[model samples]
Target: MSALVEVSELRTWFDARQGGKRCVVKAVDGVSFAIHRGETLGLVGESGCGKSTAGRTLMRFHNPNGGRILFDGNDITSGDIKPYRSRMQMVFQDPYSSLDPRLAIRDIVAEPLNIQQPKLPAAERDAVVVENMRLVGMNSEALSRFPHEFSGGQRQRISIARALTTNADFLILDEPVSALDVSIQAQIINMLMDIQERSGITYLFIAHDLSVVRHISQRVLVMYLGRGMESAGTDELYAHPLHPYTQALLSAVPTPDPKISRKKQRIVLEGDVPSPINPPSGCVFRTRCRYAESRCADSVPEMRDAGGGHFVACHRYE
Candidate 1:
């Protein structure tokens, strides 16, 4: 199957001034991946690892500093995103902040239609809003309510409803469940999966929750300090993670089976993540990697395929 979205050597940077000097923070640097039509690709990393930035960049919410973005085989790197807005949508991380407090639920859900189809009749727009709300497990009865009346989970459902109002084929779900309760997270994840099955929508699921990623993603890409560390089929990556950073992350996920938990060895990484503005040369993870060698500091390790489509960026594999 062809990729629905392809990003090559993507980079998104931010300019800042520190100590009276200009500096560039490489929020996302040299990352590449593809999301097949109707498939979910999980992007996982620690906080500040640029997963969110990558998602925003893909949506053209942030202009890329370098590289290319292709949507359904058309280059959309530096063009007006208005044309693609309806086809691509995003569910932001914070449900509380994402929704407009001033708007009623009906208006919030119909806002996209108003923008994309300005001439759409009010009755038709309201029908679309109710339909989308039903798709996200919402009722039309809540249409007149304000955002403040809903709980975090309901607010998130509203966000999802709003994203689907335009019938987007691809969704950038930036930690959509991270802010909700553990039980609510499962509900939201299941709803998303159900929606995908019904609509054949593709998703770029970004989150730090390894277990959740493993549950929903067909493939997983691990990131650290704006660079990709490893990527492989979800089962393959979890079963045999090659990169030290990947290993450490997997180790931190708690297991339900006491026997397995007792037998598992956790890999603790030392030192904090290096500043993106002054990221170390060569391997960005070398500073905290236990298996780091002198040569690891010489240059960034090229992503190498170990076997069966599993790829890791670590000199040790070479």
Candidate 2:
């Protein structure tokens, strides 16, 4: 299947003044990946690893400092994004803040339609809103209520409903379940998966939850300090992680089976994550990597295929 979205050497940096010195923070530095038409590509990493920045840049919510973003074979890195807005929608992480407090549920769900199809008749638009709300397991009764009347999960459902109003084929889900309760998270995940099965929608599921990613994604990409460390099929990467960072991350995931948990050896990484503004030389992960060698600091390792399309960027693999 052809890719619906392809990102090449994508970079998104920020300028800041620190102690009277202007510095640049490479939030998403030379990251690259592709999402096939109807699959979820999980982007996992620690907090402040530029996972959110990468998602926003893909949506053009943040202008990338460099690199290319192609949607359905068309370059969408720069230019008026209005034409692609309806085709590419985002479900942000925070449900409470994402919804407008002042707007009723009907208006909130219909906002995308209003922007994309301003001339659409009110009755027809209302029908579309009601349809999408129903798709997300909501009813017309909630339309008159404000955002404050709903719970976090309900608000997220509303957000999903709003995104679907555009009939979006691709969704950039930025931690859509992190803020919800555990039971609610499962419900939301199942709902999202069901939505995908029905609509054939593609997703870039960004989250730090390895377990959640394992459940929803067919492939997983591990990132560190604004760079991709590894990318492979979910089962392959989970069963046999190559990069040190990837190994450490998977080792930390809690296992429900006491027998397996006892047999598992956790790989605890040392030291705090380095600052993005002043990252380490060469490989960004070298500072905290247990297998770091002198060569790791001398030059960056290029992503190489180990076998079966499993790719890793580490000197050990080279």
Candidate 3:
């Protein structure tokens, strides 16, 4: 399948004042990836690692400082977003805050349609909203209610309905299930998978939860301090994580089977995540990486394919 979304050397920086001094936080530094026409690419990282920023940049929520963003083979970084807005959509992390409580469910879902399909008749737009709500397992009765009336999971379903109502082929799912209870999370994930199966939509699924990402992603990309640490096929990454950061992350996941969990040795990372405003040179992970050598402190490691399409950006892997 062709690449529905492609980003190359994408960078997003934030201006902040630290200790009364100004600095630039490289939230998404030189990240590159491709999402196929109908595949889920999981982007995993700790908080402040820029995974969310990358997703926002892809959706044009943030003005990209550098790199090229292409959706369906068109370079969007240089053009008017108004024309391409409907083709891409985002399901934000917090369902509670993402939706406006004042708007009725039908109007909330219909907002995108209003912006993108102004020429469509009111009846047609309402029909699209009703259809999308049904698609997300909500009924006509629920559409008349407000977001506050629904549970967290149902609110998220409403968010999904809003996104899908635009008939978007690409959806940026930014920690879509992180805020829900485990049971609710499972339901949402299952619902998402079902939606994908039925609609053939492509997803950029960003989250810190490895287990959830592993379950739904065809490919996985690990990020640290605003840069990609490792990327590989889902099974390949779980089977043999090459990057130290990736290894540590997978090690921390408790195996479902007690025997395997007991047998597994977890690699505990030390120190807090460094500030993106002044990320470490060489490898941003060197400060916490046990495998770091003198050379690791001298030069930034370039992402290279070790084998079997697995890529790692670490000096040790070189």
Where model 2 places Cα greater than 4 Å from the true spot, the runs are none
lDDT tens digits, residues 203-222, model 2? Answer: 99999858878889999999
lDDT for model 2: 0.93
**How high is each candidate's TM-score?**
0.98, 0.98, 0.98
Model 3 over residues 1-318: C-alpha lDDT tens digits?
A: 799998999999989999999999899999988889889999998888999899888878899999999999999976688888898999999999999989999889999989887899989998998888888888879988998899999999999999998899999999999999999888888889999999899999999968889888999999999899999999999999999999999998888899989989989988788999888889999999988888998999999999998999998877
Model 1: number of backbone collisions: 0
Q: Tell me the lDDT of model 1 at 131.
A: 91
**Using alpha carbons, what is the TM-score of model 3?**
0.98
Quote model 2's TM-score: 0.98
The sequence of per-residue lDDT tens digits that candidate 1 reaches over residues 127-166 is: 9999999998998999999999999999999999999998
- Rank list by lDDT: 2, 1, 3
Cα RMSDs, all models: 0.9, 1.0, 1.0
